[model samples]
Target: MIKQVRVVLFLVMLFTSIVLLSSQTSAAAGAISWTKPVERETKQAIKGGTHKKQEFAFGDGDLYWIHQVTAGQNQQPYVVTIPVKGESATFRYRAVAANKQPYWAQVSLRDVRVLPAASGFLETENKSVWLGKPIVYAALGKGTIDEKLTLAPPVEVKKTAGGYVLQVRLPMRAGLISEMWALESAEPLVIWGKESLEQIWLTLDVTDQAKWLYDGYYYKSPSTYVPYTETSYWRIPENYVLRSFLYTGGSKAALDMGYVMLKASLKQQEQQGYWKSLPRSQWLQNDYGISEGFYDTRFNTGAAGMMLKGCALYQEGEFCDAAKRYTLFFQQHAVSNHYVVEGTRPGWLVADYATVGKKSNTHVSLNHQLAEINYLYSSYLQFGDPTDKDLADIMLGGIVNLGSRWIVSSGDLHYAYFPNGTFGRTDYPYLTYNDLVETQRLYKLLHGMEEPTIGKLMASKLAWMEKNKVAYLTIK
Candidate 1:
């Protein structure tokens, strides 16, 4: 009886010890503390500036300090000390406007390892002195203005004897900048007590890129038209938005948002399986010079292709069914109705726009043709349809045969081939290139060989773009 009583007591003590250790571990994980700048000193005051310093106690029991200098100029410098306790750390900085005016700032992080959590457009070439390391910089800007955001080049990084200094460009106006730091190997989805590390998963600035969509604008009212520009509410395609969410590691929140967008896009499909082009009179006047609703082949192909992708990604049968509907519509109605122009080449030249209750627009944009070919080829691979492959090959032949006619003097491909036998206008440099690359990839997968013509055109366009330094040129 005494032995039994002693065993029970020992078990109770062991349980008590385990409980105490668990509580201590939880407390250590949850602890986060920080201190604001103790002193603010007026700098040389070129246009009125100040230097401030602050310290933070990251739950890992290390001290990180930020010494920032803000001026009324385009460039501000932030020096952050690396924690001595760990081999690496991840930091997030956000800048917002104080007033209602448009605010913009670019942050360049230096001395830190470039992890996948660094979400920004990384510069390939060292454009500035601060961009020497594996530099990833975020361009943060927000406003109600309809103008496109023209981002300045990344500022250079300077490492002083004291620590690593990052050059930040201040907005033209006053703004507030917030910073969050975590361990380098921290799991983004894991909530460290009250501090959320969710932003690390995003590869782009969520606040500036598609902010409205991410903020549940479309989820709230899927049918409501959101203005993209002064004339169009449908500039960014739903599929592109969905793709962004899916490509960014597919977090639960992102997948949920993607599902909402996929369903919304599926609901917007017409009975004929084609999404109608912009019906807004302003968009029509600005783009096509006609107010009639039409079926844009390029847009339709993109939306349907993305639907197919969503179906595969989310394993949703409804998305696949919708995609099949579009494929059937393209084969039966589009092909049977002869909404194509007989090209000088071997294959049937697809029309760019099929107007509602009106004659189809026969202008053949190179990008549009390539996009349809890619979609058809992808569909063939997915749905195992021989007709899709045949059509893709036929259209691809037209592109090959009509080669030099599309090539401009500068070796860049002409945007479109009008019915009047003239090539005019300019497409975005990378848009057509991306379509060509995808087509080549799909073709190689199907045939186990590379198409020389596609390769040549891709090389030519790439050369031209590199020669002209045509980075970030958004024509539309």
Candidate 2:
């Protein structure tokens, strides 16, 4: 009986050992080996002494070893290596700024075949280049890069003798945020039985906020909202950011950030119930030849509308109160102060921008009118205020009366109506369409009937977009 028991115990122990060995082998096969440069290699590769290494995990279990080099009196370059194991590998890259100041970086990846080169134009004044894979090698061997390279915002690539060189630039005070920009390669870049490397010039723009967002760095206590000290763009909570958080059913972190931003906006409200113009906003407006003085009507309307949205979505009394203040200012002050202009027709037009104690700008932008109409109508629905509906109706009537006059020769709408009775410039192709759709929905909700003019306008814009094969156009 004792010998039989020992045999059973021995069999169980042997089976457990085999299972453990198999599991260990499997894990070793799946693991990735990341290599960093030694001190001698680092000194030879980078010109600056501010080189630092850190690790980050972005999505799921993917890990990256980030090596940073700060640019001093001269631009600095640091080499990077990405090892491809299977058929391919993909990675993301971006250049950040410390403040709103502009920055630039140059990246050169060697001995690898990059797939799906960056394409399309951004809203800025940068040109694009176009080069096929074969053309890239031929041109590079000839010692001349082509001018027609595809233009991708934040990054543009040109072919090099060994591989590719990418030029990246950040616009000054543009307040632009981007989605993850990815680079994928077709195969591993092997150099003499080793992995080929890439070189990039990284600037010292990494902040606590950036590290927290990208690298999961823990802070003792983080701010509810991103502060201006982190990035200049967050000096004031942007209306679009607030709307995104509340409308999209965002995560808890996003909601907390949005709530704090809403409170900050309320605190910044003037005695007259409007916020002052942000210099960053003025810079963008200046690009479009739109001069905003003490305050902008369009910006205020959007801001107040977003606040009201937050009130209804979150059931927050503070947001409701702030929105009501703006509503009262609009009804009592804007209406009597000539900010609301009466057109030749029975409709009314809201000024695009204004200065304190003076008449507003004469040019009436279609987007501004539509946005105000949408806001006022939404206000009416939320607060049961007849004045809001009345104002919205008149402003909407102006759009209907203008009709084809607003439509350019290309079936697109003119950006704005000048005081000289002429429409000029190009508006964002889809912004007016979205505004019209919302206005039509509200009109039907209020009157129990569809607005035919708005429907026709929407159809016209859609047809033009389909004809031109335009998915999006970045006007700003």
Candidate 3:
């Protein structure tokens, strides 16, 4: 009986040892093959750094990395580059700190674009695999991964003790091309050995080979409420539209604009002197995964400013009260960060969740700042409020600090300054015109004098416009 019991115990111990060995070997191998698709585009904050850039692709597609280099508060232009598929790239993501703190090296994905990541426009080959149909395998540290595919392609991620291995096999197919770049981390981790990693990336295979595609996991672009064809142009920057009407549209048009303005004023009054921006169409949020129901500062402040102008012109009590109330919100809520007046929505193009009672970083806008400065100065003049003067000075000082960056050699103002102090494109000539007009208005409000430099620049642009037969009407 004792011998039989010992034999049973020995067999049980052997089986246990075998199972334990197998489990340890599997963990050591670090071979985690996920059969289902990890379908979601998300922004995750990293522990080492704040910003991250991660890119992943399935199958043998033309892979590239899109990197956003953020050096301190100065936001640089996104650097898009084509990286060799299955190669390792180093990222030195900087932990941007004030007081000169130590930065760390980490890998991350900056912006999260959906799976079967698209290739660049210049690349002729189609590299992105079918959406929601990728086989993803995520491994922690080091090991050799061999993925054999039967009907679909193989996506492998091998992070060895010494180095890394990423390989994607593509099935033969036609019309499988991509015209967009995926997430990328610039190699060498450091540009000039000083810039820190704003982001980094690694390849992962998380596709469910069993199911072709799940219904809930797929994402499609949002359909436009207002569609635009090749020749279509949405009349954005409505300030320009209003100015255009003021310039070319006759008395009837002016009266029509006045009615529109009155309607807007009524709406503002209805909402306690605050503009209620429209929520993004349901399809937009549901389909495109974009933020909806955001308010624009430009519209809010601009409407209030226009109402103030109306009050000054017609001596209307309601207009004056609305203007004062709207402008007063800024005094209470606007955050002064060095020279930048943050927390206030500055432009129509600058959208924020403030409409939905949420806060976002104050986006800088040169044109909006100009308008706000003019409004604030006017407010100070009309109401004799020192707060208005202080606010105007802070915004004006920030703009003046931009100097040549915002003002071209011809003195034509650039369209805007991004929140990171980067100069946005100067595509809108009307923006410069508006800036000139606002500068003149602000100067007049401040010192009862026209800004001569701005006047000269406006004249310069106007003459060129006339010579070239620009469609915009003259503003004197």
Instruction: List per-prediction Cα lDDT, in the order shown.
Output: 0.49, 0.46, 0.37
The regions of model 1 sitting more than 4 angstroms off are: 1-239, 248-250, 281-292, 336-345, 471-476
Give model 3's TM-score versus the native structure. 0.40
Give the clashing residue pairs of candidate 2, or none: 128-149, 129-148, 129-149, 129-150, 130-148, 130-149
Q: Which ten residues in a row have the lowest lDDT in candidate 3?
A: 209-218
Q: lDDT score, residue 208, model 3?
A: 17
Clash count for candidate 1 is 2
Ordering by TM-score: 1, 2, 3
Angstrom error at residue 110, model 2: 29
Per-candidate TM equals: 0.53, 0.50, 0.40
| lDDT tens readout by residue for model 1, 264-380 | 678678777877644333443344544534566766786797688667666778888999989887775446433333455466666676655455545677887898888899899
Query: Mind giving the per-residue lDDT tens digits that candidate 3 earns over 178-268?
Result: 1111322222111233221111110111121111111101111123322322221111111322322222222222223332334334443
C-alpha lDDT of residue 324 in model 1: 91
Tell me how many clashing residue pairs each candidate has. 2, 6, 26
Q: Evaluate model 1: give its TM-score.
A: 0.53
Which ten-residue region of model 2 has the weakest summed lDDT?
Answer: 134-143
User: What ranking emerges by lDDT with the best candidate at the front?
Assistant: 1, 2, 3
